[model samples]
Structure formats: C-alpha cells, structure tokens
Target: DQQVKQNSPSLSVQEGRISILNCDYTNSMFDYFLWYKKYPAEGPTFLISISSIKDKNEDGRFTVFLNKSAKHLSLHIVPSQPGDSAVYFCAASQTNRDDKIIFGKGTRLHILP
Candidate 1:
C-alpha cells in the first residue's frame, strides 16, 4: 500500500521568511504528488502539485519538488506570511489507478511576526 508521511507535526516561521515542509512516501509508483492547505472546519485547498515526470512545479509563492529516487518530496513557501499559516497535507495518487489519494497526517505552519 502507498502511504504518504509528514514527520513534523508543526513548523514555525517568521513572517517574510521561507517555510519548508517535508514529506516522504513509501511507493514509487505514485504518479502524482500534491500539497493542500486547510483551515479549521474547512476542506483543504489545492496548493501545488508535481507529476512523476517532472522534478519541480511552482506557482507564485508555492513550489512542489519531487525526488523520485528517494521517494521524497517537499513544499517551499517563499516569504512566508501570517495568511499562509495553516495545516498543509501531502498527497499522492496513481493516475492510471483509481483516483484514490493517500494523504499525510499534515503539518501545521505558524507564521510568527
């Protein structure tokens, strides 16, 4: 079975700095990787994603990096801000398989002033 894991339960970063969230997976067969941000009582919103063919994908302040060799991936948030504070989850799915997504436990990011 494929499992996504986020070891850190939380991270604290100062405003105007960078925040790095890490994730690891057990299955190399996963073809798609995604990051999602969620607030209390709200569903997670898509942040970014990377395909198995690509190593990196970026959109504005969010970037998703994949390391197929190590079965690892990371999310980078440049110039982190208070508004960026939320619980981030790492997810994986196989495109060829059913659209079942495996999600990590999630990492809560705190932007401190």
Candidate 2:
C-alpha cells in the first residue's frame, strides 16, 4: 500500500496561471506534512509545511492546504512562473521524533513561458 501517493506524475501550466498539485495519504499516524521543490539534480528544498492540527499554511507564492478528514493535501502556486518548473514532492511524517518520512514519487511541473 502506498502510504503517500501523487497520482499525477506531471502537470503543465502557462506562466502567470495557477498550478495545483495533489497528494493523498493512507496513514493516519502521519501528523506533519511538507512540500518540497526540486530543480534538476538538486535535492528537494522545503517549501511549506503544516502540522496535523492546522488546516492551512502559506509562504509567499506557495500555499498548502490539508484536509485531515479526507487524508488529502494540495500545494497551490499562484501566478506560476517559468522559474517554477521543477519536481514537487509531498512528504509526511509522525512528529516529535526522528522518524523517516514517506514521500510521493513527485510531480513534474512545467511552466510554459
């Protein structure tokens, strides 16, 4: 069973538009969720995160919304730019300890210029 899954392997959007990436999880024990962005061969960089207790968190052009009841989460990038083209990974983990994280394969976002 995939504890975390990103059904869409890729997404495309035109510049200045909205881009939304989705993620689903089956593990109820996961209490912390994070979104990371990666470009080329670089490691993923943390974009945003939300604790299970919270439903939403935002940082500049990025926003993450968690629906605990549905076990679903999404990352929204507004006014998507060409520079936003990269792979995005959704990760979840149990909080308060040194626990390993479960990550979706990733979604490749292509922003058309």
Identify the runs in model 2 with alpha carbons over 4 angstroms from their true place: none
RMSD (Cα, Å) of model 2: 1.0
Judged by whole-model lDDT over C-alpha atoms, candidate 1 comes out at 0.94
Worst 10 residues of 1 by lDDT: 1-10
- Regions of model 1 farther than 4 Å from truth: none
Q: Evaluated with lDDT, which candidate comes out highest? A: 2
lDDT of 2 by residue, 30-80 (tens): 999999999998989989999999999989999999999999999999989
Model 1 lDDT tens row, 3-105: 8999999999999999999999998789999999999999999989999999999999998889999999999999898999999999999999876889999
Candidate number of the best TM-score: 1
Cα-based RMSD of the predictions, in order?
Answer: 1.1, 1.0
| Cα lDDT for residue 50, candidate 2 | 95
